[model samples]
Target: MAEMSYRTALVTGATSGLGRGLALWLARRGLRVFAAGRRVSQLQALAAEAQAAGATVEPVELDVTATDATLERIRALDGECGGLDLVVANAGVGGVTHAKRLQWERVKAIIDTNVTGAAATLSAVLPQMVERRRGHVVGVSSLAAFRGLAGHGAYSASKAFLATFMESLRVDLSGTGVRVTCIYPGFVKSELTEKNNFPMPFLMETEAAVDRMGNGILRGEGELYFPWQLALPSRLLKVVPNPLFDAAARRFR
Candidate 1:
């Protein structure tokens, strides 16, 4: 894969965790970055840092889950940037709840942020990218998407949707010169993961995950799996018999 510069990358959920890390990493790459998130104060801090680093930073307030507002901000940015070279649909949500007791409202919230929000963000940007015949798009998935987990039923399903969505999108843009990458990162310590009650094996540092994402985006890798331990096993799950895999997975739990 050829390396692409981070000169025109738009990253979502930049207030914290992987989004923040990715925005900063891209800025360090001398990319004209549109750092998007919900927190006004945090975006301000990020702006200061990006400016100090000599990056043209546009900190836009965005709640990807919100329908009208999300699109409005995106439109505003599109006009401001003139054109976009990259869009990382990286906003996501994680929840600890039983599937049976999953509150309809809460589940919708999770779905809206992880699945609908992602789809909306990409859909909004895609026409522009296609019209220009350029741009790279990525969605941040999770190792949890590999298989169902006990408490993360909704979150896992949403991630799985992202993985599948990217596959479908790659086909849709096959000849458009637009690259689509689906990123699955495992056990990165973040506010989202801090609520987990169980142990995370081969857990990687957030910075490492961020770095991995930057490299993958720059190289235009189709599918990225980090922390080889998780990736290797996740691949095996596809071939392992349901009964045997369930038994082993339960033991690990």
Candidate 2:
């Protein structure tokens, strides 16, 4: 494992699931964490748990979809926490949409939260990292980004946007001492996946997923796709013929 290079970390969506797991992992690694999310009570509980474990965790109430306010809060936290060395824009939402029953509001929410919110979180932190010339920015995308799934078109498209955005940021920040990592996790156990009734291939538990993600960040990997059992297939899917891919994807529908 790479030695800890970051002293302070900021994690969004820390109230639950992967975000919560990442926050706790960072705290355990002895980094002071600013955990942000919309749920204040859960954040407080997380803070308490971390403190009990002899780690520092400060709960910051935030809703990433509110771009302006979210940016302001991140800036405030950067100053208050003695500047952030790492930022993970892990806040995201998922929805199942059918062509016949697709609600504009639901589709919009997914796009706003996944695409816009992810961009806002990164925008809020990148300026400071650029000025300081040292930091890591991570975006938790998904394996689903490889294709636009029938029932989750908006979600997959949002992730595809996010994956490309992270790549673009990496290109922009080259030689600037600021690193960007995109993690594409497949079928990890989380609140989002807990609702799914379909079979999840190579399903991984939360702790294992968190461990892999932490390792990736520490190693400063450009792009990390976990549980290669799924990632490899997803990568191949990108090159598959549209007709063949459509036939295979229909099983999940």
Instruction: Using lDDT, give the best candidate's number.
Output: 2
RMSD of each: 1.6, 1.6
TM-score of each: 0.94, 0.97
> What C-alpha lDDT values do all the predictions have?
0.85, 0.92
lDDT (10s digit) by residue, model 2, range 63-152: 999999999999888888778999999999998877778889989999888999999999997988999988899999999999988888
lDDT of 2 at 114: 94
- lDDT (10s digit) by residue, model 1, range 153-235: 78889999999999999999988878999999998988888878888888889999999999888888999998998899887
Whole-model lDDT for model 1 versus the true structure? 0.85
Off by over 4 Å in 2: 1-4
Number of the predicted model whose TM-score against the real structure is largest: 2
Candidate 1 regions exceeding 4 Å error are 1-6
Clash number for every model? 0, 0
Residue pairs with backbone overlap in model 1 = none
